[model samples]
Target chain A: MYFGPPGNTLVIVVSPPPDRPGLPARRVTIADIARAAGVSIAVVSYAVNGRPGVSAATRERVLRIAEEYRWQPSAAARSMHTGPRAVGLVVSTAAGGVSSASSFLDLVTAIQDVFGKHGYALLLKVVESVDAAVATYRTWWAERRFDVMIVTDVLSQDPRVEALRALRAPAVVVGAPAAAQGLTSVHLDDAEAFGRVASYLIGLGHRDVAVVTGQPELHRTQVRVAALARMLKDAGGSLLRMTTDAGPEEAAAATRQLLTSPVPPSVIVYDSDQMALAALDVARRLGVEVPWDLSILAASDSALCRLSTPALTALPSPLRELGTAVGDAVLAVLNGQSATSHVVPVGGLAIRGSTGPLARRTKQ
Target chain B: MYFGPPGNTLVIVVSPPPDRPGLPARRVTIADIARAAGVSIAVVSYAVNGRPGVSAATRERVLRIAEEYRWQPSAAARSMHTGPRAVGLVVSTAAGGVSSASSFLDLVTAIQDVFGKHGYALLLKVVESVDAAVATYRTWWAERRFDVMIVTDVLSQDPRVEALRALRAPAVVVGAPAAAQGLTSVHLDDAEAFGRVASYLIGLGHRDVAVVTGQPELHRTQVRVAALARMLKDAGGSLLRMTTDAGPEEAAAATRQLLTSPVPPSVIVYDSDQMALAALDVARRLGVEVPWDLSILAASDSALCRLSTPALTALPSPLRELGTAVGDAVLAVLNGQSATSHVVPVGGLAIRGSTGPLARRTKQ
Candidate 1:
């Protein structure tokens, strides 16, 4: 199949019109329905679309004609007017390598569910860098190939937000208030989630707490770290240690060291469930009994956390709800309406085997 | 941003051109370049594309003219006549729930990497089901949105093969030898990989071994499972147990039961890294020391396996090379060439902290 100029009319020339008594039929077209209904092409289009000017009787008549002809309107034709019924999720990196993180993998899966339910195809664009992400969005806009764009891993003062503003494109940012307010935003109440985790540990009579996180530059990580600090201060307890690793390997290395330290904290919390899994490994490696000598908590939930030996205590992020909110915002933005930013709080801290009472903090 | 027939182009008619200096500029046209080169628009096209019938000197002159005018040929315009420089990747299902069981996510990411390097944008489509996959492919073919198509998740007597053959569409299959010779295929030495792993275990004096796998319906899983059974028989030993689970949850549950059995196997092999993680969780819960009471081997390499406690032994799938092979095959089929079926062998096994010699099987 070759793509050429728009001048080419797609005319399917059948061979001799199938000169048999019961031959297979050809493709049904809008013109066939129009002719059968004794209506003009414009009238048929209006009736099919349920435009106000079309009378109810005429609309029913056109529908009856279309059913008789077994005609289906082309998806392309419909999309041309309605924009592509697809959400463009331009992830800002390739799938492999150390720098890339799968923290958003669950979110991607959830978003696909919401979009698919709404008949919107999810298009993945692997933008090698931030600049590439902006360029892909521009290209998508020019080609009219996406109805909405969902942004993740939002950096402070992201260029994509600026680009979207310039193009007046429909977009939803899974990010913080300042950068996300102009567009629509959806995220967990991260500050509250972290505060609760810290408070839970304090309630268990633990004074020494160490926190491990993903990339320190991430916006969500910053919020979580600050919340932990605040919670400790309010409880008249000081943070024993706070560490930020560059990647998964570094996170694992730090976790091993923290557990093996002579003065290891009684409780350890991570910015992600994946990181929390690393802590479990470190504890087992050092022969330090989890909950017996150390406790682990993370900011998000997944199957990994659920299936862990001590089903991890985590703040359950509402993945499906976040995805649906993004979808709703996209539709609103695309219709030239203001989509107000929303914070979908992931309430309730789930306690699992990973946590236990202070365990005589003297284990340190 | 609002859709709906574009609203008559929204032409905000400006009064002539604003009398301002350096008001940026509009995109240069083919006509301007043609005029500058003292040639026709057809000549410019021929020179830009290096087509025959254009003298070298004339081509150079036209290029110089185009450079002076900054006349970039539009991608949409260039796509005409040339096949679409994009491939449609129809993932059989969205990355949610049960679909993640098959290695579709990995395959898609790998294939995208290969295609992206070649300047081909992948038009991703998530088919709701197997039948939907076929329908989506048919529509994509009819619409001419892609130059080549990739077919994965090969099933017995697959209908996709027949559909592609009927359309004579250039395609590649990521599976076993199918009945149709018209399509190119790329498969891993799954049986060989499994055989190597089994032989390694047997050499380590592990007599009692068990295999846990993902969905058995997939052709690749079937191959690996069969290979394990055969290799054990050749070693004068038998597979102590064989089981299939739906996903990580079921795999974790299965692992718990298997490890708790009175006559537990000395070693366990998993079909995927995720499942291997589940096995690890189960072993930890049952207090069965890894590489001690039980050794673990994962079929696929991922961060989970590498970072887990007692780093898992696994075979890297040679993802980059596999991607490259798929890319090359797609290009070959598109060029009307009969590409040979390519089977890339898996890389050597990466033995880590997981596998070890079996404890002497003394009377218990």
Candidate 2:
């Protein structure tokens, strides 16, 4: 196979013919890649063949360029990626509480639908902490555990972005990391969604509202809290906030504390359906009628929302669509495409039985 | 490595002394396995070294024998097992709907807790159908996709048990597959628990009872149905049963159908807390007072049980403990030990507001 940069033109013998019949048509040629990437044929040949004459950065750019043009490596080159046909979803234990959240399940199903068709099995890992999650990613990369990974619960200033990029790992971040830093990302617009939900509540004559958020450190929670604060400020409503581990007991205890205060808020907003349900339980226990004495709203949509007594009003997320977008990003990254970002928009608030105007009407 | 058998003595020169220091202690010799298996040293050596003369069946038997006695392979041999550090949990799409069930979340946490500590990521797959699930297992085995797998929603005649067993895949069944057929299993006793719950309800002076089950095709459902039938017969009461997809809409419709019947059940047993909550909603909408006009029981336990307006009575499955047992079983299987089973016992029922003494004093 002869490859060279002749003057300003890159020259190459596209396929060195000792084809021994019909074994090379499926393979993308170096000349084809070089033309697509607009680089010298020689550089494309080196990148394709795993020769280190070119810089790693240049090689990566060339590979992404090749993938962008939908190039398929030949039998010889495909061998380099012939380990297990698996992708992974790695989560932190802190995010485990959301496992029962219906949106997560819907997203998981959607992701499996796309990846399964492409023959990539989903490997899910829930690590004890963010550090453990990072370590797991590094170990998996070193051991070639998966062809690609989907990182959930991304942090505001994610260290994983640079860490994974340094290794050129193929991964898609769910819930946009604050500083994406070249990592492929697929996430919902949490700030916009939270503002929208808050506005809906504020429009309902709710003031002196209490926001029950999940853990303070979670990137999504912090983002939502900030968005809520801004929206509430605009509506001239003051806010009381409580942060919890998002467990049933903790959420209930927090709800209890909020309701039993000297001057309790009339409306309570929750980060999870479970927390809102806990609030509902608190209402029943304390003789506070839902939507009458206290109105409730869920920041996240879930089956729990619909099943509750006065089904919760929630910000409906198009989770399945987001999952498909994540799947696409993951597949693109796995195919060596340049990292990209996607913003999956949320649906408008689902108005259920849990929310109403604060005006009291006399019983007929 | 020469190995020989004499009468009762199996002599094995397990490692040809390339100690280079303190490495031998970490490596178990072929002789150590031969004596433990009570087999000839030559067979042990053949099994350990992957010699072609030994049969595949014989090799598997020898490997299990080696693991039985705690034979740790050396770094040289361990390299063969150095691929993905991952496990998998394969569930059906029908079961995927149950992802919101608090019990499922608990099990997921437990599985991650166990597997994460040992560095095995959980690969979760929700397939389109039973056939797809089987295909996934076969493909995973062909591609060596996982180090271990936990098969949930085991069926009456589970094809996966035999198929995976044929490949000698390391898997632990969440519920006992009717035909375990050499596969490792860990399950809760569905029938016994159902009988106990039935007895409790019968003791509460209920005669006309309704038992709502999840997908009736599931083995656990069949077992529980059979048990409930027996217990109800023993108590001289007939049952009004309904099997739905266990969704909120379907469950609510079913509850409405049962409640509005000419002879409505005095007590209702639900397969899940969500269904029971839906039943609760139906009761409220119909103006039937709980505990006075009807009683409810949730066969599956979850936080939903506690958070409902009238908290549900439920059977608690210690999911974390079960997960630990599964992890231990997976570790055991990966270590090539003889296949084993563990029965995770359920705790006494969590009695709550949803259930109460049937009012024969008023209704009759």
Candidate 3:
């Protein structure tokens, strides 16, 4: 019930017997296991690893003694390559805020599942900037921390990719290959999906549309925004744009500002499901009926979109599928096979109630 | 443009001139830097690290060559306690769910700010389970991956605390200390804030209330649920509890289910700002006007809570303050001080338009 003032520091001295004591019992090694089992270190190693060449009786006996002692193979002794393999993911909020994207979370979750099933654990590092992300990746590799690394939100000519590739650190990138240089893009196309949404909106007689997305510095966002704009223009329509940090509040504020503007668009598109829903909240507050008065689109779809009032029309980014591909790409790299780019199909549009014809609008 | 079929494994065959070719120009080590500078590796180390015993001229000359040839200090060469110091955070969505808690994200973000100013960077590992989290904590320690570890969402009599203590792994737990045994909790009370909200609603003459939160399995959730139930009972009112994953869709569904019930709660309390907003969205769709028809309270305050149609009344869980305490606790542990639990002050009510007297509901 006691809380600290700004400068106060408290300490609890719980004197309990330590779980691991410094009192020396002679240290046991593989050599000791070999000596005790009356076998060579090679035989002990073979038995311990379940590799062939050790007799069943000797294997069982060696395993039993190892279990009794609770011996652990030292990392240095396992020598970098032979140690337990893990996949490392270096995520950053810096270099244009990839953290704001739900796809980023979905990708990591999917990677964890696929990697976990393969007996590979994850070493996740969420750093502040791209520089810190790269530094962590380099330091982790130099330290022999994990077997392979995963990099997300790649930049055009990313230094992280260059550094990781220069180190030949087994790596998979979750972005476009054009920006990634030679590093395989463990990426799927959300661009094509945006194009489809653009055409869908144009077809519905929306002449003026706006795309609200995350940081402009991000390669994926830039690419998607440009592609969508171009497609919208080609369809005899014009697309306006807004950028945000992708937080719900930012999105909500942008929605309110845009809606109140002198020349507001009839249709609006959002980069995230959360943001699109925020737009809905803004609309409802202002008495703007969705679809009937203002059509809306969300780039990424989730259960939130489907269940929201008016059920937002959305272009599914297939984040889990992209993540699975990313996992595969990481495995492929770790397996030392040809590191090939995995182009994932962008998810199709789910035409819910949020989008409608320009003729339906009864602007107050 | 060609993405993979579900079963297809595509290959890029990029094989660009490898960034780092096997054609070795003799690898440079500390000895090479020393030889080039006409000094010992010790002198080179002193120069590189800005340690004493090396002349300024020699230090400059040694650094120039080391930079020229990119001679680096290997992890083994740096040795234990001599390498860089970093703080470790192992966040787990394991033991049911912790991801739904906005407080958890706030804590990490806060920790990052406090630690970064002190020249410490976070090495975060988000794992799938408590067992994996504990293993990661131990491994990160043994490998000297970080100087200290951070454990969140402490359980009642948590094994992670015992394991960390046994391994002498420096750590700070984010939740209360009961489950941590003696590890210390860098947490504040939300119970008080919830109590005030209950009183506020009771003052409005609300009889029926519902508490909707995520993951009843979490110890924090259990305590909050119990406390809220007790407060509601004391007000001569019964409380209904609903468990969810705290996803917007799930919350919306729960809202619909509760509203259509035989005796719907006059006031609904949501665990997250997002969920409360979702509940609002559901209300909007169901023609159930908020405050007049049903009142709402958000457990955590964020921008999303403030921007809704009828902005939610919320209990502010000052995430940054709790996070700062967590950072200080980790720092204290790393500094080799006795583990101290710092309680954070609970936040006051941010009364918005979401709540109104039950008699006011009769108007609609």
- Model 2 lDDT at residue B160: 66
**In candidate 3, what are the lDDT values of residues B205-281, reduced to their tens digit?**
88789988877766677767777788879989988999887777778889999998988889999988778888987
Best by TM-score: 3
> What TM-scores result for chain A when each predicted structure is judged separately against the true chain A?
0.75, 0.73, 0.82
Tens digits of per-residue lDDT for model 1 on B129-153?
A: 6677777676665545567878766
What are the per-residue Cα lDDT tens digits for candidate 3 across A150-193?
87777766788887766666778888887776766777686787
Which model, 2 or 3, shows the larger DockQ?
3
lDDT of each: 0.69, 0.72, 0.71
Model 2: which docking level applies? incorrect
Point out the higher-scoring one by TM-score: 1 or 2. 1
DockQ of 3: 0.22
Arranged by DockQ, best first: 3, 1, 2
Any runs in candidate 1 off by more than 4 Å, and if so which? A1-84, A94-106, A112-119, A239-247, A260-263, A360-364, B1-85, B93-110, B117-119, B143-145, B159-163, B166-169, B179-182, B240-243, B260-263, B360-364
Top lDDT model: 2
lDDT of 2 by residue, A1-364 (tens): 2233323333233443363221223234456677655577888778867997876666776777665444544322332346446686766756543633445566787887887788777777655677777776766665555678787767676666666665556778886646566688888888898888778878888877888887776677788888888888888888888988786767888889988898788788887777787788888889888888888998777765886778999987677888899888877887879878899888788999999987533222
Better of 1 and 2 by lDDT: 2
| TM-score of only chain B in every candidate structure | 0.77, 0.74, 0.81
